[model samples]
Each structure stands twice: as C-alpha cells, then as structure tokens.
Target: MSETGRLILLGAPLGNPADASARFREVLAAADVVAAEDTRRLTRLARDLDVSVPGRIVSYFEGNEERRTPELVDVLAAGYTVALVTDGGMPSVSDPGYRLVRAALDAGLPVTAAPGPSAVTTALALSGLPCDRFCFEGFLPRTPGGRRSRLSALAAEERTLVFFEAPHRITGALADLAAAFGADRPAALCRELTKTYEEVVRRPLGELAEWAAAGAPRGEITLVVAGASATPAQRPDDDALRAAVAEREAAGLSRRDAITEVAAGYGLRRREVYGLVHEG
Candidate 1:
C-alpha cells in the first residue's frame, strides 16, 4: 500500500491451473505491469483462469532478468503495481524475479507475494523421506564435471536434499548422485507433478539411475534424496583401528601418515591411533 508502488510476486501453478490462488488472479489481472518468465505461458494461464491481464506484459527470464530489472524498478517507482511471476512456482526461487525484487526493495518500493504450490515441498512431502529439515538445491550444473563436483561437495550433507532436473539429464544426474551419495541412498523421483501422467518413483539411487538409463523420462523432474547418515559415536575397537591403519599403510601411506588419516577418519586423536597401531 506504499505510495511508491508494490511488486507482487505470484506463485504460479506447477502444472495445474487450479492451483492458482484467488489473490493471484486478482493481483495479476489488476497490476499495472506484469513481468513474466514466459509471456506466452502467462497468457495461456490467464486464459485458462478465464481472467484478463490488461497490464503490459514483459518478458523477465534468466536471460534478460539483469537487463529488465532496472526498467521494472522504474515502473514501480512511478507508483504502478507490478506483478512478478515465473513459468511456475514462486518467483526468484531458481527462477526470474530475484533481480527485480532486490531492485524494488533497494529502491524502497514495497514487495509481497501470493504464495502458491511449490515443487520442492510437494516432492518432499510425497517422497516419504524425512522432511523435518530439508534443503532445496534448485538444479545441479548441466555439465558432467560441474555436476560431479557439486554432488561431491554435497555428498555429506545431513539434511534431506531436493533438486530440480531436466527430463533429458535425469539419467546422468541420477548416476552422478548415486556415485556421490552412495548407490543405496534412498531417493524419490517426482515427475510431472499435478499433471496428467504424473509419476513418483521411490527407490535407491542405483536403481533410479538404472531406470533412467533404460528409458528417458519426459517431464519436469524433482528428486528428493535422504541425507547422509550420521557417523556413529561409538569408537572402533583397537583391533579395528589397527586394521584400518594397516589398510591405509598398505595403500602406500607411510605408517605415521596412515595413522593420522585413520585417526581423523575415526574422529580419534593421532596419538591414540599411533599408540593403537604400535601397541605391544
């Protein structure tokens, strides 16, 4: 209600028009300007809702977001309500509208949201995985090396992880996830949520990878993976610790280095491992 203007972020439906809220339609239809990731898709959505968007619709996507943010801010500064929406889900969540929102706030313009459905929460809830705490990793890098590096970094993350992936890359993504997290890691693949022919496959990473490789899935895909298990607090027995050090030593590490590495791995002091390894 500020005199400067308001930037309303509307959460579009994942794939169902019915998911759009009454306030979403009200704000979208009455806004002075609408910044949409895909104007065509927004048009279709408006049509589906039997609503008329009389505002000037402009394209605001990843490719053009940086360039268009200033212009949108100018409109907001002029005291015209601007509704920000993406192809799906909330704006600025791995989607467009982040720049404009930031710009609006910086310019002291009002900003708010009409929250709707989100694939992150939907998939997490339907995944049957622990959702008490979770993290949403919108999408992994498209490149193999980049994806592997990112996955490797997240291998030990303890919170349930959610990710968005393209239909075409699901195979390689699942494979990399399995290799990084562990083949037996439990994961759920939610595809085409809220749409006809929707699918939710819950399985181990290894099996999901194999299934993707066998046949390409064709829809928006959300992956929910169980977090890494916490390392047990119980310390290994002396014999086990000694054997661990010996295994590392056999792998070309010097006794001192092997003991150090083993100790760190087992959360024990170096001297303790050293003593255990050299014990009479």
Candidate 2:
C-alpha cells in the first residue's frame, strides 16, 4: 500500500471496461482525489466496474492540465492520495497527466501507477513487427509540412516506430510515410483496439496510403512501422560484387551458389550480382 500524500497514475482500458484490473479497482476506490481526463467517462467506468469511488471527481484534461497540475500537487502535498486517470490508457502518454506527475515528483511527493491496457504495446504486439527494440513517436504533426519534416528526420531510425493518429488524417499520414520511408516499407494500422469493431490492416506504406484514401475508418488509430535496414544503403560496385563472387567460387562454391552468397552479403538481389558478373 502506498503512503498518504502520494500520487497514483491509473491506467484505464483502451475501450473495453472488462480490461480493467483488480488493482485498478482497489486504487480507484481508495484515492482521496480522482483527477480524470473525462469525468463522465470515468463515472461510467466506475459504474461498469461496480466500484465505489469515495473521492472528489475533478476534471484534468489537456485544456486545463496546466492549470490543474499545481492544484493536484497541492492536494498531494496535503497528505492526500490522488489518482490520475486519463480517458484511456495511462496518463502522460500522448495524453494528460504529465504535468501533474512532474509537479509531484519535483515536490518530492511519491508517485506510483496502477498499470492498465496500452494501445502502444497492444498495437506493437499485434502488428507482427519486431518489438525487441522500438520507439514511441506519439502523434505526428497535423500539418503536411511539419509531418514530412518529422518523418524525414526519422527516415533512418533502425528501431521499430509506433505512432497515434487521427482517422481523418490517416490517409495523408500514410502517404507521407510512404514518401519518407519508401513505398515498400511495411506497416500496420490498428483501429478501435480492444473494442467490438477492432480492425488491423497490415500492408506496405504505399498500399496503406491507397487504402486509407479510399475510405478512412472511424476510431482511435495506432500505427506500427518496420524499421529501416541496418545495412549500408549504398549498393556494391560492379568490381566489388565480381570480386566477392569470385572469392566465394575459389572457396569450393559453385558459380550459382557464389552469386547467391555474395548478393546476400551485400543486401542485393541475386540477379543484380549475376548481371554484374556477366555484363563483361
């Protein structure tokens, strides 16, 4: 049990009330002050969970987060348990709650969390992409120019990338992604996660862009994109390719096998290697 005068960050289910954990219910019921991104939604959630919140319910969303942080920290400093809950997922994750958390930390107040469902991790797991290493980019800029600049800067990032996007902007975002990362870059679009109408679309960036342009789905969206290749982008010169093939052939390998080996080593197509060797 956390001591008094501590801040607890609560994680709400993405869309399903059934995803709420037992610990979350306990903490929600115990908090002295419940700062919610959406008070109405929080009320509905508490009703669904059959948990009684014997605490003050206050609005703590984006528009008022700045103004509310100091007040929440003051409450925490006064030996009260304050629980911060966003509309969904954990607070401060492309959502409200960061300011209040930072204020509490700076004031030497205790801060903890009741872990809940996360769209970021959920989408990454279902995307069928590498998850060993990844970077959460939150939401991209809404404007085309700004989004392009951000995407261009991240073009060479070797770790898998995750992002939150709006349904209305998904088409343009995917088009920009294709242009920056290349048409063939693999990606997944997860929609209405943990909800009845859940949908996951996996495709190349260009194809995704086309699909989105055709008709954008309505709901919260999470995107997972494959990383850029770690290998050097520059193709091997003809002489280099020829030399590698010849060296492999001298090591008791057949010409066909040598070409395949050399191509794999240089991250090139076997036909490129063959053409290089036969273009005498």
Candidate 3:
C-alpha cells in the first residue's frame, strides 16, 4: 500500500474551535477523501477553521457505520488518504470511526491520527478525581435493569471511571451509581465543557444524586467517579446482616431476594451473605 493511502483519525474540537491542532488542519486539507460522522457539522467545522477540503466528503455515523466501513476501506485501499472525523472529540472513542479504522488496519493499510481536544480528558482534568489511572465507561445501558446489572458488574473496578450521560438521566444515573459504588464515593459532574457556561460540580456521589434530583442541568455532561477505597477488613456483624435481611424481607422481599439485596447493599458476595444468614 502506498504511504499516501493511509487512514487518519482526527480528533476535532469538543466545543472550542481554537483547540483544533495545526496538524489537524494540515491533514484535513490534504486528505483525498473525508468521512465524517456528520457531514454538515464537518463542513461547519471546516468553515470555522477556514480550511478548504478539496476531497470527497461523505457521511459515516452510528446508523450507517457498519454499512459504510467496507466502502471507506475500499477508498483507503485505492490510494486515497481517508480522513475520519467525528462531530466532536476523538473519533472511535465513543464515536463512529472505530469500525472503519479497524477494517483499514486489518487490510494492512497505514493508519494514523491527528490528536485534538477531548471531552474525556477535559472532564477528568476538571474533575479533581484521581486521573493517574482511569477508565472511560463511554455510556451506560439505557434500560433500568441492564444499567443496574452493568453497574453491578463494575462494582469492583478499582480505576477511577468516566462516563458521558445525557442531561435528563443525570439524576437517575447518579442514584444508580450511588447504589452500586457506595454513596460516600467522590465524583464530579462537568457540564458544558469548554463552553462559555461551563460548570463543574465536585462532591460525594450521594450529594450529587440529591442535587440532580432537584433539577436536571443543561448542556452536555461528563461524570468522573473515584474508585472504591480499601474496603474494611471486617464484615458487618451477624446481627447487622440479619437485621438488613429481615428489614428487606418485611418490605415484601422473599428470603432469597432479601439476601441478594442486602448483599449488594453492603458490597458483600451473595454467598457470604447466605452463609452469614444461615449461621445466624
């Protein structure tokens, strides 16, 4: 493959055009073809940067990504420097460019990137959480049960975690996170990142949950949650566990259901809860 026929992933400005890198402009103007998640947004961004792209511009987004990747791959293989950009942030990082990039790589085509602003890093930096070791969770499942199960699975994740949530679900998501990761966990809610009205609210997860419940904030949101601290060596006393189980059971939960609920509440394994219940 010719060196010129490479796939380049470009990270666009998250909210500020000034954050666009010099390399980003040079590559965008040099590509043989530009595939963007939103063609209109790409055009607008190009106008904003005053960069004229003399290449074919096409739409590639979540809905059409699977169907369009093969075509884009063909363009890359045909000696076209295919430049991929998302509406904002880094392409393929919770965006629509992963499939095309993967296909290009597998086909032995050269691939590269022009790094620019990213909401993930921006929010993490503003979060005041431990960013040294962190994980980007992208987005949570929309359904209540699926979201709950997903959060439950991440209960033991030790790295600080980041997530993008819509404004409307902010409160409920925070509540679910509190239930999964313990209310005392520290977190930050970053809104309208890099924009004129940007706001960052840092607090314990429990307090965030309460604040969200009062009113949903406007603008795009990014949440950074601190990981679990060292769990206490000693488990709750047998009487305490029994009382929790009994309380749930009295609230119409079956013995089995109450055991599960109490176990999750205390971050204990279900088997351990069962053993304790039986022992008492």
- Candidate topping lDDT: 2
Per-prediction TM-score, please?
0.81, 0.82, 0.80
Candidate 2 per-residue lDDT, tens place, 165-271, comes to 99889989999999999876667899999999999887667778998988987899999997886783477678988998899789766686577546544556557
Those runs of model 1 whose alpha carbons end farther than 4 Å from true positions after fitting are 231-280
Ranking of predictions according to lDDT: 2, 1, 3
Model 1 over residues 116-222: C-alpha lDDT tens digits?
A: 98989999998766799999999999999999999999999989999999988999999999999887677889999999888988766887899899998899999
- Candidate 3: residue 179 Cα off by (Å): 1.4
User: What lDDT is reached at residue 126 by model 1?
Assistant: 82
Q: State residue 97's C-alpha deviation in candidate 3, in Å.
A: 1.2
**Best-fitting candidate, scored by TM-score:** 2
Runs in model 3 deviating more than 4 A are: 1-4, 231-280
Q: Is candidate 1 or candidate 2 better by TM-score?
A: 2
lDDT of 3 by residue, 3-65 (tens): 448999998988788889999999889988899989998899899999999988999999999
Clash pairs detected, candidate 2: none
